[model samples]
Target: EADIYQTPRYLVIGTGKKITLECSQTMGHDKMYWYQQDPGMELHLIHYSYGVNSTEKGDLSSESTVSRIRTEHFPLTLESARPSHTSQYLCASTKATQETQYFGPGTRLLVL
Candidate 1:
C-alpha cells in the first residue's frame, strides 16, 4: 500500500451538500499537504502543515480549506459543495524537506 489513502474514489453530489474527502498517512510524516488538480495539469498546493497545530495556507491554497488535527490524518471538508467545486482532490505527505511526496489515488468529485 502507498503512504496515503483517500476514500470515495469518485463522488457525485447535488448543488449544496456537506462532504468531506478523507485522507490519511501511516508514514508518521510531520509535513502533510492537500492539492487540487485536474487530469492534465500540475499539482496545486491548497493547504499544508509543517506539524501538529501548524497549519498554514499555501500560496495557491485558496478556494478550499483543510485541517490538521492528528499527525496521521488531514481531512478536507466542504460546507456546501457546488458544481464549481468539482475537481480531483489529492492528498500527499512528505517525511522531510527535499524528500519526495507520496500522493493518494484522489477523489474525483462531480457536483450537479
Candidate 2:
C-alpha cells in the first residue's frame, strides 16, 4: 500500500476561517484523488489529477481548490470556510499500471 498522510487529522475552525488540508504520498503514484463525504453518506469526488501540474475537478462541485505542484503533494485549500463545508476529506493515489488505490487517513473538518 502507498504511504499516504494527511495532516491535522481533525480540525475545528470558525466560519470564514481559511484552511488548507494537506495530503502527500511517498509511493510515487502518478494519479491522485480527493473525495468529500458526510457521515453515513456516499463519497463524493472533489478533485483529481493525472500527474504533476495536472488537476481536474471531479463530479462534485466544491468551493475548494487543489494543486498538484509535486508528484507526492496535493493540497486542497478553502479560502473561506463555512459550516456547510464540514465533512471528511479523503485522499487516494494509484499507479498508472494498477487499479488499486491507496488511501490516507482522512481529515475531518468542522466549521463552527
Candidate 3:
C-alpha cells in the first residue's frame, strides 16, 4: 500500500494567515504533485516536482507554492490565506518509471 499522508485533514483560518499543508510519502516516489479541486469537480494540477531540487508550477494559476528537497516529501504553502483560497488540496506521487499515482487523503482548507 502507498504510505502517502497529509496533516491537519481540515483547517479553518482567518484571512492573511500563512499556512502550510504537509504531504509526505514513504514509497520513495521521485515525482510528486499538488492539485486543487472543489467538491465533486475535476482536479487542477497546480504544482509538481520531478525529484529533489526540481520543482515546477503546473497548468493552473495558484497562490500556493511547493518545494521538493527530499524524494518523499512535497509540502504546499500559502503565504497569505484568503477566503478565495478555500478548497481541497490533494497530493500525489509516482515513481520515475511508473505511470500510476498514489494520492494522500487530502487537506481541506477554509479561509474565513
List the candidate numbers ranked by lDDT, top first.
Answer: 2, 3, 1
lDDT tens per residue, model 1, 42-89:
878888989887787776746566788889999888889999888898
Clash pairs for candidate 3: none
For each candidate, what is the lDDT? 0.87, 0.95, 0.93
Query: How displaced is residue 5 in candidate 3, in Å?
Result: 0.3
Off by over 4 Å in 1: none
Error of 2 at 18 (Å): 0.7
lDDT tens readout by residue for model 2, 1-112: 5699999899999999999999999998999999999976999999999999999999999999999999999999999999999999999999875679889999999999
What TM-score fits each model? 0.92, 0.96, 0.96
The better candidate by lDDT, 1 or 2, is 2
List the pairs of residues colliding in candidate 2: none
Q: What is the C-alpha RMSD of each candidate to the true structure, in Å?
A: 1.3, 1.1, 0.9
Residue pairs with backbone overlap in model 1: none
What's the CA error at residue 110 for candidate 1, in Å? Answer: 0.7
- In the range 1-112, model 3's lDDT, one tens digit per residue, is 8899999799999999999999999998899999999987999999999999999999999989888888878999999999999999999999866689989999999999
Error of 1 at 68 (Å): 1.1
Model 2 off-target regions past 4 Å?
none
What would the TM-score be for candidate 2 when compared with the true structure?
A: 0.96
